[model samples]
Target chain A: EKASQLQTQRDSLSQKLQETELRNTELECQLLDLEQRLENRRLESESFRKSLRSLLELLDGKIFQLTELRDSLAKLMESDSS
Target chain B: EKASQLQTQRDSLSQKLQETELRNTELECQLLDLEQRLENRRLESESFRKSLRSLLELLDGKIFQLTELRDSLAKLMESDSS
Candidate 1:
């Protein structure tokens, strides 16, 4: 009788352990997915920063050209007026 | 004899259950931490996107101004040539 009871107890424990192990595996998978999402976000942010830099440089060039053109035009007008 | 054996089995299962519970709690905490990290990354990405939009608007305005300046200069040159 005692042996049978012990056998039953062991069986139950074995089942519980299997369930816990399965749950652990699921949690680990979830953690991996979350980390991957974070990595993607980081990359996206990096690309945006690069885009910002390129845009700023392009705008600066345009501004420079405009300034140069305006100055030359002013000089021409002054000479013509004189 | 069977009763004593059953008691022993119960004791062992109880111990195993306690240990499993502890491990489960730890996994749960880890999962929470990972989720928090994901949230922070999402926020950072959102801020970056917002910044990009603002920068694009500013750059557009600058480009428009430069184009206007260039057009005015062309008009002045044409008038002088005529």
Candidate 2:
């Protein structure tokens, strides 16, 4: 009587453990997927930063050239005015 | 007799299930953290893009102004020479 009851409990608990382990594996897979996605996003962000930096450098170069032109123009105007 | 064996088996499997549940909870928490971190990085990336856009607009404006200045200077020189 009591023996049969214990046997049944043991079987039920073993089943529960199996279910739990299966669920654990599923969660692990999901975490791995999230990690991979995050890695890709990080790479994308890094490339964006690199591209922006180069663009800013190019704009800075253009600004420098324009400033030089402006200065020369100012000098010419000054000579003209004088 | 057999009751003792079954009871022991049930206890051990119950313990395993408990431990597995705890680990599962921990994994869920970690996944939540990764999601939050990814969200933050995405927002940061968006802001960076916005900043770059505005900077490019400002640089375009500067270039336009410089070109205008250059054109006027060129006209002045032509008149001066003529």
Candidate 3:
């Protein structure tokens, strides 16, 4: 009877170990997928940053040109009045 | 001798089970942390998209104003020359 009990306990532990191993594999797969997604997102963010920087620079150039034009118009008006 | 062998097998399996269980717990913690980081990254990306949209709109407005100013300057120059 003691031997039988030991066998039963061993069976139960063996089953539990299998289940845990399967769960570990599943979790590992999920983690790998998540890591790849995060890497892709990081790359996308880097592109976004670069695009934003370019847009901001373009906007700055436009504003500078506008300011120059406005000053030229002001000077033109002053010369016309004189 | 057979029973002793069985007992030895059971002990080994039990030890393996414990190690697997610990590893599972560790993997679960890592998964939880990765999930939270992904969520946070998602929120940041959303904000970045919104900011990009706003910047584009601002750039559009500036271009329109620049065009108008350029036209005004051209008209003034033509009238002054005439």
Candidate with maximal TM-score: 2
Q: Which ten residues in a row have the lowest lDDT in candidate 2 chain A?
A: A73-82
**Decoy 1 TM-score against native:** 0.70
Candidate 1 residue A58 Cα shift, in angstroms, is 5.3
Off by over 4 Å in 1: A1-8, A54-81, B1-13
lDDT of 3 by residue, B1-82 (tens): 6677778889999999999999999999999999999999999888877887897798689779968978996898789954
Order of candidate numbers by DockQ, starting with the best? 2, 3, 1
List native contact recovery per candidate, as a fraction of 1. Answer: 0.46, 0.86, 0.68
lDDT of 2 by residue, A1-82 (tens): 9988888888888888899899899999999999999999989878877887898798789879968977996898789954
Q: Give the 10-residue window scoring lowest on summed lDDT in candidate 3 chain B.
A: B1-10
Docking outcome class, model 3: medium
Go through the candidates in order and give the C-alpha RMSD of each one to the true structure.
Answer: 3.5, 2.4, 2.7
Q: Give model 2's docking category.
A: medium
Model 1 lDDT per residue over A1-82, tens place? 6677677877788688778878877877887887788788778778867887897798689779978988997898788954
- lDDT tens readout by residue for model 1, B1-82: 7668677777787687778778878888988998888787778768867887898798789779968977996898789954
DockQ, structure candidate 2? 0.80
lDDT of each: 0.79, 0.87, 0.89
